[model samples]
Target: MIHKLVTTPMNLVIKVGEKVKEEADKELYDLPTIQQKLIQLQMMYELGEISEDAFKEKEEELLIRYEVAKKKEFEQWEELTKKKD
Candidate 1:
């Protein structure tokens, strides 16, 4: 009936939002991926594949990106907590 029609669309929208949030969570809190990139940068520097300046520059960029990701993660956690309460 009308109730079913109304709730169906609402449910679909909620489910879609949940899926998007899950995907975002993966990208935002992906620590392992960040760590691997850091390791690669270190290896490149140690192997003399890149100069000190390049290494420092890349490392700084990566660290900044990690910081932003951590911020996003924190914000997302707070949002979820608020929703639960």
Candidate 2:
């Protein structure tokens, strides 16, 4: 009974941490969020709020992230399809 009391709280904490990490990943790697960021960055450049070099650097980062997000999304879809079959 004592062991269960100790381990049960630890297990709940671990599950909560995992859920938080999953949510954070989804927000970070979300396709629409990345695209919106890119659009905002371009607007900043066009409006003279950011320099060409800075804009290019940020754009490249966003592009790379977009590609990774796209690949992840595709893989997730594939997994879902496989599960259904």
Candidate 3:
């Protein structure tokens, strides 16, 4: 028995691709959860979405949060590894 292949149109392919990207975006990255948000804010600043002062303030806040999260993640990983050793 021969199986026939169905060809997908370009528009359908693009729509499906976009939906897959949207679904993937819903899942959070494991490291530095706030990193993306920080970058987004930085980009907005670069794009002139807000004033320099406001951008600086938000950048500082996000950076501090990112550092704290990174440290906590490191500590937790170290503890888990130590247990295995």
Candidate 4:
């Protein structure tokens, strides 16, 4: 009983942390969010706020994230269709 009492709060905290991380990941890799960041990056480049090298590096990272987001969206759609069928 004492062990359960000690572990219960810890387990709850861990679960909450996992849930928060999952939500953060979803937002971070969201397609629209990535696209908005890309547009902002482009604007910065055009305004000469960021160097070409820095813009390119950030652009590449965002593009990679966009691709991953697309793939994940497709997979989720497929799963939903499979469930319906």
Candidate 5:
């Protein structure tokens, strides 16, 4: 009983922290942010701030991120459409 009492608060805190982190991550990696990041990467490459190899790597990473965000957005839209139908 004592152990359960002591652990319950900690468990609750952990769960809440996880939920907050998940939401924060979703916001952090949203489409517009990813797009802006790609633009920044391009500008960096053009201005000699980043090398061609680094630019390619970062661009690919951002493109993948954008695709993931787009996929999630499409899934959400499909869900809403299904609900309406």
Candidate 6:
């Protein structure tokens, strides 16, 4: 069975954000993408795979890469959606 969402106009952005977040969550653990690496860094930090200083360093690096990747993905999505408008 398929479920449906009942979103109003004002909730459109929220819905999209949730969808994007869901996609990001899925990709975070699947491979060695930026988000995946970020997930790894987070796990390492939590599980003591690296020192606090090392974890902080890798986390910062991964975060920067994640932001860049996320921006690119958003731009591509925006381009595609805008073309349909």
- Each model's lDDT comes to 0.89, 0.97, 0.75, 0.96, 0.91, 0.75
Winner of 1 and 4 under TM-score: 4
Question: How close is every model to the real structure, measured as TM-score?
Answer: 0.64, 0.90, 0.60, 0.91, 0.79, 0.52
| Candidate 6 lDDT tens digits, 1-85 | 1233544654888899999998976565333587667777788888988899998888887677667667777887999999999
RMSD over all Cα atoms, model 6: 10.6
The TM-score leader among the candidates is: 4
Model 5 lowest lDDT segment of ten: 24-33
lDDT of 2 by residue, 1-85 (tens): 9999999999999999999999998888999999999999999999999999999999999999999999999999999999999
Candidate 4, run of 10 with poorest lDDT: 24-33
Q: By TM-score, is 2 or 4 better?
A: 4
CA RMSD of each candidate after superposition: 5.2, 1.1, 9.0, 1.2, 2.4, 10.6
Cα deviation of 43, candidate 6, in Å = 2.6
Candidate achieving higher lDDT, 4 or 5: 4
Tens-place lDDT digits, model 5, residues 1-85: 9999999999999999999998987876688888889889999999999899999998998898888888889999999999999
- Output the lDDT of residue 29, model 6: 33
TM-score (C-alpha) between model 6 and the true structure: 0.52
lDDT of 6 at 35: 62
Steric overlap count per candidate = 0, 0, 0, 0, 0, 0
RMSD from true fold, candidate 3: 9.0
What TM-score does structure 1 among the candidates reach? 0.64
Query: Candidate 4, after superposition: displacement of residue 48 in Å?
Result: 0.6
- Candidate 2, superposed: residue stretches over 4 Å from native: none
Per-residue lDDT of 17 in model 3: 96
Per-residue lDDT for 4 in model 5? 100
Q: Name model 3 segments beyond 4 Å from true.
A: 1-32
lDDT of 1: 0.89
